[model samples]
Target chain A: MRIAVVVFPGSNCDHDAYHAFKHVLGVETVFVWHKEADLRGADAVVLPGGFSYGDYLRAGAIASRSPVMDEVSRFAGKGGPVIGICNGFQILCEAGLLPGALMRNRGLRFICRDVFLRCETSGTAFTSRLSNGDVIRLHVAHGEGNYFATPETIVRLEAEQRIVFRYCDPTGRLDPEWNFNGSLEAIAGVLNEGRNVLGMMPHPERMAEAILGGTDGIAVLGSLLDYLESLPLKGGKRGEVAREAAGAAQKGAEGTKGASGREAGGRCKAV
Target chain B: MEETMKAKVTVSPRRGVRDPQGRAVLGSLHALGFPEVVDVRVGRFIELIIEPKGEGGPDEVEARRRQEQRLDEMCRRLLANTLIEDYRFETEP
Candidate 1:
């Protein structure tokens, strides 16, 4: 499969992602600069982790406005698969491709360590290879990875099964300490309404090989490839209905907040 | 008569950082008998005042604009991270 990894100023993980795809997955990969507007015949795109724009303003805020993001948005709109890791996830949120926003760690500390993530939904192309509740270990390194969203949005995401992963223990038990950044509901990742776009705080690329302690991440990447291979040669009609539904849900939640004195719940669960 | 120009710039996390200061403040508030504090984040404020360079001349506006622009740039490049910090400025004469 052809893959494109977008590179922006201060993006340090682009090369790492390239290696994962090129060496481990044996896929044809290309580096697309953030200024480039074209995907150059790529079937899927990966926004690698790193401190884009030096994590200035917000981890992914500046990079979201980069020129290449227009193309990325269009590609996602066309139903192309996109996976954003770490800061890339931040950018996706900043670009509005994903719901919610990444906030500072609740502990006000930068966390860098191996984290456990429980698979929430295996129905999507990103997690089809894994079983629901499957636990995978990956590295999470960031200061601002906490995810926040209004209550209605969280409810809709849960109802739609859009949440993909949650911070948990190796035994797949929800543990607060396993939550690296205190993400709402201990969410480590989520999928867009289309389910083709994914944003996660953990770095799967860092654990794609056995040498990295385990090969759990390979399954996640493999799932993407499997899904891409299953797609019809011609791109399918984009899914706008899901987006509309999500927007409506957000509005409903906002309206509820306006009328009631209740605060929004955590994206996953209240800690 | 001379006119003075003033500008106020406020800088904050593009996404508010988990603020230990705010948390501490919240803890103190809780100790003082308030427990509804959910989260807290801190931000900064900066203000600058300058004399009008010239009466409505391009040079004056350009220079002032450049100065303000420079300050904004400095906030992102040095004072704040373009990624996690945002800044806004207001000007008055």
Candidate 2:
């Protein structure tokens, strides 16, 4: 399962994403430059975090109009799984691939810290490994992480079961105090209508390894790997092929654009 | 003949959308002796100078119309994100 991580100018987390997928998780990952128009036969695409175009106009705004985005949009259109992390999420929203817009944080501060998030749904590839009500911890750092949508869109998001994660206390109780960014509904992540595109203000790549203080990211990223490996014709081998392909992918890393996945946040519940 | 038109575009959060930045500015305003300021809305201001292509006098009216139309299109396509903000612009020769 070859994955393409698109990089735009000023993206800072591209290497982190590359390490998580290629080195830690042993997945075949590639770096796709933002100036390029193709995904190069990659199965899924990742829009990593960072200040693309220096977050000009708006976070992820300029990068959304990059050449690679058209290809990413087309890929998502064909049912390929796409994940936008942090600024990546902002890009997805700006590109109209996902609903809602991320505005300045409620308190008007650039918050950087570890937060808890409760799994709101188990239907998406990003959260399939986790169960409803499960809580995971990831890092979040941004000045504009507050998520907003029109009332109608918010209602639709709830009715359609597209919300993937929400902030909560350690015991999984929802509360306003825990909604650090003041995101509407205390939302931390959401899925598109197709259930293929996921945009979250948190960085899962930053926490994929246990040495980094936790392995909760496995439930998210690993679930994606699980989904990919389970594919009959599209995905092949877990025993040996995955390892060799991953090694080859690391060697081919020089060929594209990149950005980092911003820190992630998840609400906590009773384990 | 070549003529230049000056334009200004304004983009702001729609009513009912939260305005944390505006609120922050309002708080500061109130602190600075502007108690009468009960409401504040932060917005972006952009200026543009347009040089309409094609010959000028014969198609002046048509050129102006197309210039305005393109300005509107630019706002819709890039300058403003209608999902959350409202945008309007005016041009002058």
Candidate 3:
């Protein structure tokens, strides 16, 4: 299937995503310029990370208004898979495609390093390849990656099980010190209410291969492909796949013998 | 009359949200022996001059009202993200 990588003026990870999808994953990939109105027939959309528009007026605020985002919004509305990594996550939130916001890191430093995450939900398009409570390592680099929302919004996110990932120790313990940016509730990523849009601080494209020091991220991308392939031949209607996936995830959570292991927290070295 | 309306906007992190930059500044102040400082919230200041669209037809009062409305819209749309920050503006008479 073809994937479209949306490129804003200052996007630095566009090529990394391109390489991962085109060469590593063997998926047809194309770059859609910020000025382009159409997505050029992409089945899925990835907004790669960078200080788009110099992070002017706040990170991702300006790029969120780019001409191409109009098309991205249209694509997302139809229940298409959209993954926004790092600054792209900021854009998604600013554009109202996702909830909450990414604020300055609590430590006031630009963090660039590896962190572990536990899969909180498997129903979303980006997490179908993972089991609930599976832990993986990914790299995050940003100055404004702290996630914040109203207490009520956080509660709603929890209740809906839209939290796709959360920061954790390598052994899968949910401790405050492992939260790289101090995101609220240790949230490392979240799915939109519709479950099609994913916004996360970590860069999966950066860790798609074993040579890059890890292959954990491929689980996320592979999950999207698997979800797309599993849909009815017609692709069904909006929310069809999401609904089925949620049911499957719920079943998986209930039937797995390892459910208690998840609660105990340690599975293995995350990466 | 394509008069230019001037405005000043201030944007800051909402209360109770962590302001790391402001906290860093606060730390520096404390190190400089300013224990009196108990809190800090870093923010942004922006100045905008809006020119009316092409020989506007509105009267002076109406034009000013429209300008104020546009300024508010600007703040809501771009100048501030109401989710994590708050914004206020002052316009020239």
Candidate achieving the largest lDDT: 3
Candidate order by DockQ, decreasing, is 3, 2, 1
Candidate 1 per-residue lDDT over residues B1-93, each given as its tens digit: 157777787876545334555777778888988888776656777777766545546566577777677667756554444444577878777
Query: Pairing residues by index, what is the TM-score of model 2?
Result: 0.88
DockQ scores for all the models shown?
A: 0.17, 0.79, 0.83
Q: What does DockQ come to for candidate 3?
A: 0.83
Candidate 1 local lDDT, residue A138? 88
Strongest candidate by DockQ: 3
How much of the true A–B contact set does each candidate keep?
Answer: 0.14, 0.71, 1.00
Indicate whether candidate 1 or candidate 3 has the larger TM-score. 3
Give the CAPRI rating of model 2. medium
Scored by CA lDDT, what does every candidate get?
Answer: 0.76, 0.81, 0.83
lDDT of 1 by residue, A3-121 (tens): 89999999988988999889999999999999998888787899998889998655787899899999989878755778999999999988889998887788877888898999998
Residues B1-93 of candidate 3: C-alpha lDDT, one tens digit per residue: 566767899999888878888889999999999999999999999998777776446577787677778888998998999988899999873
Writing each residue's lDDT as its tens digit, candidate 2 over A48-102 gives 9899999888899899999999988877765567899999999999999999999
